[model samples]
Target: MESEQFRRSWPFTGVVLWMCLALPASAVAQDEGARLSALELLIRSPQLGGSDIPRDLPGPPGGVEVPLRADASTSSGAAMAGAQAVSATTLPDAPVRPSSGDASTPGLSEEMSPGGPEGSSALLSEAPRTGVSDGAPLTLLPESSPSRSFQVLPAVVAVVPGLLFHGLAPAIAGDGQTARRLFAMEGAGLGLIALGGVPIALTGASRRTIAPLYAVTLAGFSVFGISALANLYSVVSPTFDPGVPAATLPPLELEMGYQYVSDTSFDYDHFVSLGAVARLDSLKLEAVARLAPEDGNAQVRFGGAYRLLGAPEQRRGDTDGSSLDAELFGLYHRYPTEGFIVIGGDLGLRGRFAMSRVSPALAGSFAEASIGMSLQGYSYPGPVSDGNLHEQLLYSFGYGVWLGRGGPFKGEAMIFYDHRKDGFAGGLRTFGGGVVGNFGLRGRALLTETWGVAAEVAAGGALVGRLSLIYALGGES
Candidate 1:
C-alpha cells in the first residue's frame, strides 16, 4: 500500500515540475508579444520611420532585445551560441524554443514573422511620388486670354475692303441723281457689312483678318455714301440742297456764248449764239447762283425745293446720272418746260462754274472746286426752232476756291462741254473762264456751316458764256 501511494504521488510531482519549467517560456512569450506590439506602433508611425529613432542594438544570443524589423539580419555567432546553450542544458530531451533575440551575431531571425516581409516589399514596389499628393494630370487652355477691344483680328478682314469702298465712293458716283440712289443702296448694303463684325466679336476668328474686314466695311459704307451725297448737292440747284454743303463758299464766275451749226462737219459755217453754264452736277442736284458778264446774260431761278434726294420711286434706283441742267428731267419738267412755270419737256447738258466769297469762314473753301455732267432731251427749242432739240452731252470738271471775311459766298473755276443735235440745232465747244466775288445775292449759308451765292463766266472757243445766280446751304451747325 505504501509503494502504491508513492507511485501515485510521483505522477503529481511530475506534473508540478512541468508547470514550473513552463513559466519562463510563458513569460518570454508575453514579452515578445508586447515587443512586437511596440514595433508595429513604430512601423505605423511616420515620425518613427523618419529621423526620430536612435540605433542601439547589442550582438546576438546573449542579447536581451529582439529585432522586429522585417529586414532584420542575425549573426552566425548568435545561432551557434544558442545551439550550444541548448546542448549544455542537462534536462530531459525536448524541442528547443526560438531565442527571438536580436541575433545580430548570425545576421538572421530564428523564426519568420507572418506577412511582415511581404508587406514591406509591396509598399516599396509602389512608384515614387511624381506630382502632388492627389496625383492627377494637367491641362492647358486653347485661347490664352480674353480679347481686348483692338484685338479684333477677325474684323480687320472685312474692315479693310470696307475702307476702300468708303474712300472711292465719291469718285465713282458720277452724278447727283446717282449719288442719291447710292445712299439708299448703301443703307441696305451696310446691313451685310455690320454682320461681318459679329463673328469676330462673338466666336473664334482671326483677329487680324475678320475683325479688320468688319471695321473697313463699316467705314467704307458710311464714308462713301456721305461723300457722294455731299458732292451731288453741292453743285446744281438755286435753293439750298439740304443734302450737303460746300463747307465754305467758292468763288464767283460769269460768262455767255451762242452757237449755230450751219453744217454738222464744218468749222467754216456762220452760226453762233450766246450761252452760259454756271454750275454742274456730280451725283445729286445742286443749288448754285451764277452770273455771266457775257451773252446779255441775266436770269433768276428759285423754288421752295431744297436740293434733296428723290423718293425711291422717283429715282428708280437705276438713275441715269445726268446733270439737272442738261438731263431729260422727270415728268415734273413736262408741264410746259422752261422758266420757273415752263415745263421743259426734254434733256440738255448744262455745265457751269460759279463761286463767291460770301462765306464767313473761307479758309476751308479750297474744296469748293466742282465738276459735273448731264444729259437732256428737249421737246421743243422755241429759241432756236421747234424741231425737238434732242441729243445732249454735258460734263464739268475743274478746281476752285472761295473766301470771305463777311458772308458765305462760293467761288469756283471749271471747264464744261455741252453737246446737242437737231434740224437747225448745233453742237459747239465753249472756252474761257470768269470770276465773281459772290455778293449776298442768293439765299446761301453755312454755320458750323454757312451759305451764299455767286455768278460764273467761262469762255472757250466761240466766246460762249452765261449769266446766273447760285447759292450754298448747310446745317445751322
Candidate 2:
C-alpha cells in the first residue's frame, strides 16, 4: 500500500512541472506577437485611412489578442478626419494607392499601396530624385557645351578673300570695327594703284617719265602689301596691339663714306664721300661732297630747307602729320679727265605726308613730292665752248622710312627720282641725245652709338654704288 501511494504522487509531481514550463513559453510568444502587430499597425495606418482593426487577424502560437491602440476609437476617429483633409488639399499629380472596392479615383494602382509586395520592390528600384523643385523640371546640357576650337574657315577667308577684301575675314568673324578699318585701307590701296598705274600706261614707259612712275608704282604696291598683311593679322590675332612709338631725329648728324661709280662714260671708279646736316629750330642746313681721288673727279652740294607749314620742330612727336618746306641748294661738279666743269643753284618746295596713322607697318614712312628750277652754267677746257646759263626743271616724288627708334642702331632709307639731267651724262643728252631719267636709293645704318655705315646707288645715265663708314658727331642716339 505505501509503494503504490508514492508512485501516484510522483506522476502528479511530474505533470505539475511540465505545466509550469509550458506557461512561460506561451507568455513569451504572446509578448512577441503584440510587438509585431504594433509595428504593422503603425506602417499601414496612414495609407489605410485609419480604418477599424480586423478581428480575425492571426496572432502568435499562444493565440493572444493585441489592441491596435490603447484608445482605438478616438485615435482612429482623429486619423480619419486628418486623412480627409489631406485628400482634399493634396496635389492632383500626387501618387495614390488603389482601394479594394473603390473605382472612382483615377491614377490609382494596387502596387503603390504600403501593404503590397510590389510597393517595396518599386521603392527599392526607383531612381534617385534630382534636387530641383517639383514646380520646375531640371534642364541638362552636354559636358562639352562650353568648349571652343579654332576654325580653319576663318583662316582661309583671311588669306583668300583677305588679299583683295581687306576686312572680309574680320567681318565674317563679326568684328565690325576692324572690318571698317580694313575696308578703308583697301580703298586707299586701290586708289594709289590707280594713281600710279594710269600715268605709267599713258607715258608708254618712256625713260623720261620712268623714274618717277616707278617710284609711284612701288609706293602703291607697298600700301597694298601692308593692307593684305593687316587683314590676315586681324583675323588670326584680333587682340594684338600694333603700335610703335614715333622716333625723333637729333639736331645735327655727319656722315662720311666711300663710293664706287659704274658709269660706262666716266674714267673715275672710286670716290670718297662726305655729308653733314645742321638743324636750327625750323631751319635745316645740309652739305654733301664726293671726290674721286684717282681721277680728280669731284662734286659738291650745299643746301638748306626751311619749314613752311605743319608741325614745328618742337612737335616732332606728331609722326602722323604733314609738312611743307622751302629748299635752296647750290652744286659744283668737275670732270678733270672729261675736261668740263659745271656750277648750278636750285630752289624748290617740298611736301611730306606721313601714313603711319593709317597702318602700323607703315610707321615712320612718308611720301614726299618736290619741284624746283635749276639754273646752271657749263664751262669746257681750251676755250672751245662759251659758258652759258641753262635752265633745267627738277622734280621728284618718292617715299622714305625711318627704320628704327632714335637709338644706337637706328637707320633710314629713301627711294627717289632725280629729273635733273646736268651731269656728264646730261652733256651727252644735250647734243641730240635720247631723253634721260634717274632713279636713286640712299640708306644709312648706325651699327653703334657713334659709328655706322652708309650706302647709295643711282641708275639712269650711269649706275653708281657707294659704301662708307659713318661717324655721328652729335645726335639723340
Candidate 3:
C-alpha cells in the first residue's frame, strides 16, 4: 500500500517543480521588457528628442543596472510622464562594442567621427553614469583622435594639383595651419613675381634697374618653389622622423684626389687636386692646388671667409645651418702650352637659409646663394699687346641636404651652379661667349672620426670629375 501511494505522488511533484522554475523566469522577462519600454519612451521624449535609441538594450555584466537621467526641461505632460517612468526603474548595462562594419569605409569613418552619434554612444556605453543632477543636461567632451600614420591620397595630391595650388596636399592631410601658410606664401610669391616681372616687362629689362629687378624675380621663384615643396613634405613627413642639422664640423680637414678634365680648348686632360680647410673661432681658411703632369700646368687658390651673422663652422649648433659670411679668395694659374698666366682675387658674400623656417617638413635641408665679383689680369710669357684687366661676376646658388642624422657619418650633398667664368670647368662655350655657368653635384662624408671621402662631377665647357680622400684633425667621434 505504501509503494502504491509514493508512485501516485511522483507525477504531481514533477509538475509542481516545473511551475516553480518557470514562474520566476516569466516574471523576470516581463520586468525587463517594461524597463526597456520605459527607457525607450524617455529617450523619445520631446525634451530629449532621441528616438533612435535601440529598443533591445544589452544586458550588463554581474547583473548591475544603470539608470538614465531625464531632462529637467520636460514640460509637456507626455514627456514628463515618460521621464518619471524611466527615473523609477533601472536598465542593464552592456559592454560597448565597436561597429561590425568595415572600418576602412569612408562613410562609416565620417559617421563615427567625434561629432557623430556613434561617438556619443561609445562614450556612454564605456563610462559608468552616476551622481548627476537630474536638472543638468549631459555634455560630452570631445575625444582626441590619433594622428594618421601615413596618407597616400594626400601625397599623390601633393605631387599633382598641389604642384599648382601649393596647399592642396596639406589641406587634404587636415593640416589647416600648414595649408593656410602655404597659400599665403604662394600668394606672396605670385605678388613678388608680379612686382618684379611687371616692371621688367614695362621697362624692357633696362640695364639701369635690371639687376635689382632680376634679383626680385629670382627671389619670387625661390619662394614659390620652396612653398610647393613644403606642402608635399608636410603631408609625407608623418611616415618618418625628420632629420636635424649637425651641431659641429671637423676643425681641420685635408683632401687629395685625381681629377679628369675634358675640354677641347686645353691640352691637359689629367691632373692632381689637393685641398685643405681650417676652422677657427669666426674665420675659415681654405687652400686648393691642381697640377697637370703632362703639360706642366699648375693652379693654386687660397682663401678665408669670416662669419658675419652666424656661428662658426666648427660649432654651428646655435643656428639651423643658416649663416652669412664674407669671402675673399686669391687665385694663380700658369699655362705652359697656352703661354699665359692669370692672377685674380674674388670677393663675395655667401648666405645659407634653413628650409625649416619655411616649413617644419623641410628640416635637414637648406638653400645657398652667393654674389660678388672677381678682378683678374692675364700675363703672357712673351711680349703681348693685350694687358688690360678684366672683371667677372661671381654668383652661385645651390640646394643642399644634410646627410646622416647621427653616428660617425656626417656630411652634405648639393646640386649647384657656378657663374664665375674661371676655374677648369669655366662657363658653357656658346655663340654668345658662354653666358651660362657650370652645373655640378658634390658630396662629402666622414666615415669615421678622422677619415672621409669627397666626390664631385661638374659640367660646362668642360666635363670634370673628381674623387678625393679626406683626413680630419679633430671632430665629434
Candidate 4:
C-alpha cells in the first residue's frame, strides 16, 4: 500500500517540484529579452536607458585578469569577487575556449580560465597580450591570458576528497555503518563536483581555447554526487528541498529542459544511453571601458537548457540556447594553421553532460555556443538496464592534445581520467579521441569552398560509428 501510494504521489510531487524550479527560467528568459532590447535600443539611442543604469555599476574593468582579488584596483575587485561568490552557485560550467571561429590554433587549451572579474592566478605570470603569433613560442604569461580569472575547476577535484576527509571526518571516526562511511565519501564527492568548476571560472581570462575535457570531467564528479544524494535520501528520507545558489540569493534564474545522448557502439555492437543535460544559465554583469572591449570588457548573462545528448551528441543533432548563465567561452578568435600535431589526455567527470551540438557555420568551422543543464544521469533516454542515474551538479576536467590541427584529418589523442568515483575508470570512460575528416569533392576553390561534405566518426566508449553530412550553412558565397 505504501509503495502504491508513493507511486501515485511521487509523480505529483515531482511535477510540483519541476514547476517551481521552472519559474526562474521563465523570469530569466523575460529578462534576457529585456536586456537584448535594451542593448539593441541602446545601440540605437544611447540616451534612453543609459541614464537609468545604476551609476554605481562598476565601469568596464580594464587590463589583464588578476588571480587574487587583493591585487584588483578599487571596488571593482571586491565587487567582482562578491559577484563571483554569488554567481558561483548559479553558474554552469562551460568548456568553450575551443569553440570560436578564429581559435584555429592547435592544442593550446583555454581551460585554466579567469577568477572573479578576471582575477589573478598562482600558476601564471601577469603579462599583457599584444603578441599571440605562433612563431613567438607561446610564452607562459598568466597576466596576458584569460585562464587567470576564469578557472574555477579546482572545486570539482578538490571538494570531493577534502569534504569527505574533512566535513565528515568526525562521522567517519565514530563507529558507523558501511552506509555512513560510503555516504561521507559520496557526500564529499558531490560537494566537490558542485564547487570544482568555480575556481576555474573565477580566474578564467579570454586568451586561450577552453577544452571540453575540463568541464567534461564534471560528469564524473556528478556521478559521485548523485550517488551520495540518492543514498542519503534513501536512508534518511530527507526533504527534497535544496539550497539556492548565492547569486540568486534574493532572486535566481529558474530553468528546466530535457536532453539526451544516444550512441551506437560498433566494437561492442550495442546501443547505449550516454545521458542527458538539464541546466540553467545564470546571468552576469561586468563593466569595461568602451575604447576596446577585447582589451577590456565586462559582461553578464543568464539562461539554461536541456542536454540533447552527451559525449557524441554533436553527431546526433544541435541543442538549444538560453540567455541566462554567463556564456562560458565568450572569447573570439582564429586558428593559425590548418593542421598541426597536439598531444593530450581526456578525463571523464562521471555522467557530466558532454553533448556537443555543432551549428550551421558562417565560415570554415562551427561557430556557436552550447546551453543545457549538467546531467548526473542519462536525461536523453528512459531508465535503462543500468538502473537509475543520480542527479547532481557536476563537471569533468582533463588534459589532452588537439592533434593534426583543426582542418581535415584532425585527430585528438587524450588520456582521460574518470573522476566520478576518482577510482579511475578505463572503458566506461572513453580515452582515445575521435576523428573528423573532411573530403572535398572538388578542389579548395569556388565549387569546393562553396560546397563540400564531411564525414565524422568516433570509436571508443559507448559510441562507435561513421556518420557523414554535407556542409553548407552560410559558407563562402
Among the numbered candidates, top lDDT falls to 3
State the lDDT at 92 in candidate 3: 46
TM-score winner among the candidates?
3
lDDT of 4 by residue, 1-477 (tens): 154458889889987666555433222111133334323433332133221211111111322222222222324343344333322222224332321111221211234333522322322224333355422221322222231121223223224543343223223323144235445546565556556455456557122322343444344364454333322222221122211111111111121111111234111222111111222222222211111122221111212222323312122212221111222211121111212111111212122221111111101111112222232222223445543343222233222222222222222222232222211011343234522211111111112322322222332233323222223232222
TM-score of 2: 0.49
Q: Can you tell me which runs of candidate 1 are displaced by over 4 Å? A: 1-389, 405-453, 465-477
Candidate 3: regions farther than 4 A off: 1-241, 381-387, 429-434
lDDT of 2 by residue, 132-228 (tens): 4432221211123232234567669988867778878767876676677768867876787788779888988787886566556555665565566
Question: For every model shown, what is its TM-score relative to the native structure?
Answer: 0.21, 0.49, 0.61, 0.18
Worst lDDT run of 10 residues, candidate 1, spans 435-444
Number of clashes found in candidate 2: 1
> Which of candidates 2 and 3 is the stronger one according to lDDT?
3
lDDT of 3 at 140: 23
Q: Report every candidate's CA lDDT.
A: 0.30, 0.60, 0.71, 0.27
Could you give candidate 1's per-residue lDDT for residues 1-477 as a string of tens digits? 245459879989887666554433222222234333333433433243321111121222222222222223434443333333332322233233433344221222233322443433332233232232432211111122332122232223223443433222322322334334434445554765566556655655575565355444444343344333323322322122212223322222222223322333323323222222222222333222222233222223222111223222122222211112324333222212232222223333332222111111111222211212222344444464544333322222232332323223323322222222211223333243322111111122222233323233333223322233323232223
lDDT of 2 at 38: 39
Better of 3 and 4 by lDDT: 3
